[model samples]
Target: MSDDEVLLSHDDGRGVRTLTLNRPHRKNALDDALWRALRDALAAAGEDREVRALVITGAGGAFCSGADISGGPRAEHPTYRMRMLSDVALTLHELPVPTVAKVTGVAVGAGWNLALGCDLVVATPSARFSQIFTRRGLSLDLGGSWLLPRLVGLQQAKRLALLAETLDAEQARTLNLVTWVVPESEVDAFTDGVCDRLVGGPPVALAQSKALLNEGVDRTLRDALANEARAQGVNFATRDATEAFAAFAQRRDPHFTGTWAVPPSLTDMNGSARSPGPGHEERLRQAD
Candidate 1:
């Protein structure tokens, strides 16, 4: 496939975007082209304001079979290739919007790390996960060394990485590696429901909450509390928060249009989003 065809992107206009790994013939393994495409796609998604929630999934039946160890382009300097992966990892991890990994089939090596980079993961019951690096006579990279220990604690993380054993979806869930494990047939619908809930949420509030939670483990109790307070203050200033309050008082559902001030490029809005006025709930319901 052409480089442009390596990844597919779609936006629902209701504030949800999906990036699909399109090299399904190889079970969506990351070749140099797909890796570059994935990184660029993620960077673009992070800057897209209408993308309140993003989903990463694979085409065909598989999530990803990990990096293609076989034939593909190689970076003349190892640092350059590794640096590209680091950029993708950091961009995905620090994106202000929530991201969900809708996983199926196998997610191993860097592919598994890619899913772990997302804020949440929804997977099929038959999904498989593994570090797989040790088996390849290699050590871990792609931030797996840092992420795994945090997610499942040090000992378990060491076991997984060192042994390179495969974990079934349920086992991954038990270890807190996978968020939810649904039947393969229902994965799409289930993921869509998750996206809808996220899309309906206040974007600024969600982003701040995600940021706070991401830092909580590394910060002192006092520091975390201070950070949370500052985030809450920011949330209080958003029009979406005001809309939420008004909707509650009026006994109606809230409509959240993700509008927050940042790099003007991150938002298409000329000003902060204005709270919905009277009859807004009906209009929203009708539009839906």
Candidate 2:
């Protein structure tokens, strides 16, 4: 692929962002370049105050078939590849904004786990999911081991992983692996409606609620409750929260920009958080 082939398309609509994986010919499989592209795209999205909701999907048909095992070994070697991939996983899991995965055709191996990592998954009836790692003689990565059990419970997770079963959308839904299932024809419309509900909510409150739930399983009850109060405190300081109450009395949908008291920022790999406004990374790249 050329450096400018647009491996990922970052489309912003109103307060929602839809990132489409663009390597359709290979079913949008993750490769080294695509991995870096996705990571940077998400990092930029997190720092976007205007982005209230994020959606990840694939171009053409397939959501993703998994990593591109066909490619020659990357120059960075195996350990480096794993680290970069892990960073991508961690970034997705901890993104301050709500994210949705819109799965269409095949979602297998790491691809299925990618959907699992999202805050919500909207899949078409034709969507297919599988834990295909064993089939390839490779173990799961992309934080699948951590996420699978939490999502479908240990027993079901084991059954899926050990058996490497391919599950249709409805079957996956029954397993609690899919949040919403719609007809293939209506996937886009249905996903858009879901994004509308997300972007219309008080952004700070929505983000805090997402964090609370995602972290709740690991937190002690005392810490979880304490974190809930602290998250509430963070929400209380936002103008959006104030406006939400006013809109409630006015019986109108509240507009949320997903902004808080301070400016929007992103944390670098070094773990320092700094606000650089919108298109910060792009501007930096351009300057370089």
Best by lDDT: 1
**lDDT on C-alpha atoms for all candidate structures:** 0.85, 0.83
Off by over 4 Å in 2: 1-13, 72-76, 258-288
- Candidate 1 C-alpha lDDT tens digits along 75-160: 58778778888988898888999999999999999999999989999999878999999998889878899899999999999999
List model 2 lDDT by residue over 61-93, tens digit each: 999998889966567569988887898898899
Give stretches of model 1 more than 4 Å off. 1-4, 72-75, 260-288
Q: Assess candidate 1 and give its TM-score to the true structure.
A: 0.87
lDDT for 33 in candidate 2 is 85
lDDT of 1: 0.85
lDDT of 2 at 127: 93
TM-score of each: 0.87, 0.85
